[model samples]
Target: MCNALAFVEEPTDKHAKSDGYCGRILRAQTQGTRRDGYNEFRLRVEGDPENYQPASIYRVTLYASSPSYFRGFTLIALKEGTEGTRDDHYAGKFQIIDEEDTQFMTNCPPAVTESTPRRRTRIQVFWTAPPSGSGCVILKSVPFKKILILLQQLLHYYHYH
Candidate 1:
């Protein structure tokens, strides 16, 4: 049950992404499958994601644009070009930093998530690269923006009622 792929089923909700691609930072999520413009959220990696050595660790930071914050999120790393492929497995393991607020999910890719939602502008975590020969990886995430999250709750209430 901890495998957070959550229905992998399409969210029929009007607010959900039609393609069901949820949150892919580097992938092409548009009409022509081109990368979208930068959002208010940023996922910054301290090391070279393209040249990471086997079994190495890198610092990852998620920052929301000033005056904005998020309460929860899920982050995962996948090797480039492996999206939706049978080999689309997670490329590394995450080192938990805030045990009180964050946790590593037991999902197929063993991603990291918020254990207890907390509003904040930035969240940091460390990722250990996979074994030898693992190439560049793309960190992907779906951040629950604070205000939008509240809007979603209201929408859900109205939709259900």
Candidate 2:
């Protein structure tokens, strides 16, 4: 019963071909050392040019079979090619829901912000795996609108192992 989080990223382009969306699972790997009835894990996700667009915010949600085995989650955005600089361009937050799910919201900095938009190839999330052994975790992502748009148009299905 390894703990995990799955997620999906919708295509940035509304007119994208195919089903008009893309999804994937967040890969979980052992991180550091486990101690005090808690285990550390890192969830890594890659961004695809075909699915990701500049200046778009993606809402990622993590679902667990049971909340008792879940602990807490954190996201740390780091600057590219820098050792100690914190990147503020991207913003993210996590929320626990009904003891069964966790929602993560991430905002990508606007492409036009600094004359040159930074493209992120990867995102890293840190979480504490429950010692009680949670079954599995699922992560999903969808587009977040800053302007008026149909709520139905924003819905899509994506599943990852």
Candidate 3:
């Protein structure tokens, strides 16, 4: 699920680079990404994703086991389909927890991105779950790197009781 993701950001936004693709620089679509390193980085959600409360905030953390800092990053909340599949459209809205390091992307689903050209690890991005009956949500993230970037990745989830 991490290998296949893409989005466009407005060029006018000071925080946005507008590579036409937020993660992996969009060049991987033709060339290819660093396939040997998918698990090195991922987004981590801090609660029960399946039982998310309507209109509540959930904390999403960027986890990078790699020593490399990303050029940028983008996080999106995608609604889980009927059978754990992706719904195609974004699920809920994203909140910028670290205003100094992150900015909200102007997308219909409303994602968040890194404000600076380079970003450190473990920054948090908050998300508001959709209203009642919104079902489950899957948090996806793609760490941006112009060269030798890893593919997009889904969140590393920990179920809460």
Candidate 4:
């Protein structure tokens, strides 16, 4: 069994905008499978409801106490015939466990559609956890530009932008 599994932040209006936007981990659960365990997580990013940019991209990072326990990661299943491809929205693997953190970007559209202008976008991810371990995980989200700089420093890679 996992030792500590909790949402990094509760979904609320107050926490909806820490800065220009607010990133919250809405849910995280572990499901037992025949071969391995699946750690499912849901993250939401909220911007100004009245002035939110649907095309805006956000960078999300997942930190684990035992990084090696996470063998693989995949975004949750999406609706068929969706307009966007995972490659179109997903930035792919940024930093792996070797760097003590895992990072990715949400370049896709919001999973949930609102009748009116809504401030929030959400995505689901599945992390393959080792069969036996007691590790904790935490997540954070920030603007893509900031994360790009940080990734360059952490990864020692240069980006034209």
RMSD of 1: 8.6
- For lDDT, the strongest prediction is 1
lDDT of 3 by residue, 50-142 (tens): 466677777878766667456666666655542112334456677787788889764322667777666575678777777666555656566
> In what order do the candidates fall by TM-score, top score first?
1, 3, 2, 4
Root-mean-square deviation of every model: 8.6, 19.4, 11.9, 18.6
State the lDDT of candidate 1 residue by residue for 1-161, as single tens digits. 01111101110112333222222321322211112553556777785344666777778887777765767666777765555333345677888888886787533335676777678777888888777666656677656644465347545655764
Overlapping backbone residue pairs in candidate 4 total 0
Q: Which candidate is the best by TM-score?
A: 1
Candidate 2, residue 120: Cα displacement in angstroms equals 28
lDDT of 2 by residue, 1-161 (tens): 33333433331212222232221111111112234644222233434222322233443322222211222332322222221112332223222322232234232221101111222222233223223333333332222122122223334322321
Residue 155, candidate 2: C-alpha displacement in angstroms: 42
Between prediction 3 and prediction 4, the one with superior lDDT is 3
Q: After superposition, how far is residue 134 of candidate 1 from its true place, in Å?
A: 1.7
Deviation of model 3 at 76, angstroms: 0.6
- Which ranges in model 3 have alpha carbons more than 4 Å from their true place? 1-38, 48-50, 81-88, 107-109, 147-161
